[model samples]
Target: MLIVKNIKNTIKYFIIILAISLSLSIQTLKAQEVAIKDIYFHTDISFEFSDTFGADRYNHFHEGTDIMGEQMAPLYAAVDGVVSYMVNPEGSWGYAITIKGSDDYTYHYLHINNDTPGTDDGNGGIKNAYAEGIERGVSVKRGQLIGYMGDSGNAESVGHHLHFEIRKPNNEPINPYNSLLAALNSEEYNPEIAKELSGTINDDKNIVSSSESLCESNTLIKMADYSTVYYCGADSKRYIFPNEKIFYSWYDDFSDVVILGVKEMEAIPLGGNVTYKPGSRMIKMQTSSKVYVVERGGTLRWVQSTSVAENMYGEKWNTYIDDLPDSLFFDYNIGEEIVST
Candidate 1:
């Protein structure tokens, strides 16, 4: 009887362990599916938008992005989804359509064109507004053309453009300017799924990276006996400078890197890479031509126009550019494009 009781207890413990393992596996799969690298947003269009866009009403704020494009320009599905809502005639949203993606994100395409192609008569009707066979409950694939830009609803006099909005599963809005840019430059390579650590006491612990240098920075540090430089962030972790360009972007010279023993450095752990300082320099991936300026934190804002760049940084603005390594692109997040000086 005791043997049987022990056997039953062991089986129960084994079942519990299996259940925990299954739960972890499920969570990992979900994380992979929702990673930022896997997400896509554009089918075929290039337009400007800003997360700071505040197209406010008398009392309401902008809940979606206003994508500046030509009147009657083609509009495509931002994701693979089923059309959930459509409003014709003239409401506040004008001719609008909403798609609910399988990822649980809701894509709102509002203020679609409702006027004649060349006039703002507001009589284009459903045929001019929606794509063929597009209606509520219809399935649509990403980049599939479903409508045209319009001056419908409250935007009758404002201009012709598509007001695109992305809503989370809870229906809250996400600032989609960056995501739209990502979709616009869809050919850009995605970051690796696995990244190796940059700084740690490797097998040759005595000489870190074969050199140690000091610099002027807010919170820079390094192993007292080694040469690799790190930025001691306010978050209490050390971040690698990666290269001289990144180092000089934040400081002029190595006159201030705090040195501590390996024992002291190990206590801080590793944070990541120290991004270029805001307003210090412009950057672009070695493989891409898009120039960007560093904003506060790791936000990378595109230098949208040559004139804007020259106006802000001078006629020799191109000289300020630095080639950011593509592998390190994931270290920063794209922000609103700099359209004006």
Candidate 2:
């Protein structure tokens, strides 16, 4: 009986010690911070969170954090890692680089002017040809200059910016803003998830703006001062909100004005006239005068000037049955042909 009691007491003491050790281990893990940058990461440009996520517009989530910067800004490596995924494809993220960190965290850097190696990111887009330089197959250190910033993607009006993303092993996008706070301060910070923009779909075929539904109680939609007036969304509603970086194709002065990912051309009848089914590959640009169209299929590119491009940005998630053109197409007139480099 004495031996059994002693053994039981030993086991209990061992359990208590293990619990204390585990608690200390967790505190150590939470306290560590990787020394990264010396600048206050601003959220002015592309980092603005919106409801657009692939095809599921309303229910989907924002994928990455956009780092607004001047054209050709230097993009530094956050931590020492090799390029795990390097996709040189065009569109929203023209030339993107994904670096795996030592702590098993993945960091994504997009809108690059060039990649280190001559290897293709396998997307095979237009920006691949613009490849200027890289330090291919070499292990890069933390804060190493990986690439330069450029407007290398699909959207024309978008200034040069870096679309940064941090993901876990499960491939879900973790908000970069939360991490930004820690880099701003040495402690590890928590990220805030954006609230979903919700609204009811009426049976009378009526379409309402997401802002009108998502707008806080005291705020109201107002026009910009001494700026261009325009109409948008399914109901052909005119909007002019200053200080908002809303980008759309600006065709000629006589043409129809349409906003990307706002409302379909078919919804307003005057905006996007043509529509493409979901998952189809198409390239479009809004110039200062008119809209240009391009279609991608196994890499043969051609121009269609008069053809009103169908739903490119908006398909499954951005749908309005009462309107004509889908969210992808932009309703605008062309003044001159503008090509992106």
Candidate 3:
């Protein structure tokens, strides 16, 4: 009788282990299918969303989601990509930074504080990174610090928070609340709030038709003296347009640029400065407007052009430039001076 009981116990344990393994495998497959894990929280706070994607604003439909946080809180990259557009329009999105993700999605971080001045290239838009070398065409990694949270633009009186949006490759706004929820990976996620604001959960299927004809139809237009490229995607009779400038001329300049990889460095908080210990090697990255010393740290930091030259490069700054054959260089200007907050 005792031998029979031991055999039954062994069978039960085997069944339990098999069930657990199967459950984990199923979850892993689901996560892979969604592709939502690439998105992340814009700020360094809890994933509490104050406003949901597709929520109704006063005049127009709220295309993005809002997260409330303290002013000057660091904003991070939602995915690895290049800085696409940095604009600080008056009485609107305030200081905005848009990054084109490797997956072709454009992530927008809006309503940042107006700390740095605007430039001519940005059409008098506010600064995105505190450092000089951090601009259009600059490569950034996931979770890298890009800006700060603030009530810039129309949110001056509203409160300190971040207005975040995720756009399709064609520049059409997709509901990001689901993506945010997936990023949090929390059990306490409030589906009710998302439903109240967006009117539907997991509504992408309803918004875009599965027909291949609708997905493949696209039209391109050149604007801003051919410096900007606009892509319009057709969803049956309706066309999806970019909320802001999508592709810029400077992107072509990346062909001549060589990526400098650095490892084991520490980044200075608040300021976009990075520090390296003795025996560290540095590389000079020159854009059309400014130069940056690329350092290998926890995160890449583009130290100010002059500061990097003086401190890291010293006298060899000019002579020690990276040698890439047939490299093309161009000069670009920033926007007008920024107005004081």
C-alpha lDDT values of all predictions: 0.67, 0.39, 0.47
**Backbone clash count, each prediction separately:** 9, 26, 13
Candidate 3 has its poorest 10 consecutive residues by lDDT at 264-273
lDDT string for model 3 (235-268, tens) is: 2222212212111111223233222212200110
The top-ranked prediction according to TM-score is 1
In model 3, which regions exceed 4 Å deviation? 1-37, 88-92, 115-132, 186-341
For model 2, residues 1-341, the per-residue Cα lDDT tens digits are 99999999999999999889766754443333333333223222223333222212233334555666654454656667777766544445467777777666778776665322232233333222222233334565554445555555642356656667676666645556556654434321111100010011110111222223222211222233323433343334433322122222211242333223333222323222222211222333332222232211111122222222222223331221112122323322222122221
lDDT at residue 209 of model 1 (Cα atoms): 19
Q: Highest lDDT, which number?
A: 1
Model 2 regions more than 4 Å off = 1-60, 88-93, 114-137, 186-341
TM-score of 2: 0.33
RMSD of each: 25.3, 21.9, 22.5
Q: TM-scores for all candidates? A: 0.43, 0.33, 0.41
lDDT of 2 at 294: 24
How many Å off is the CA of 129 in candidate 1?
0.4
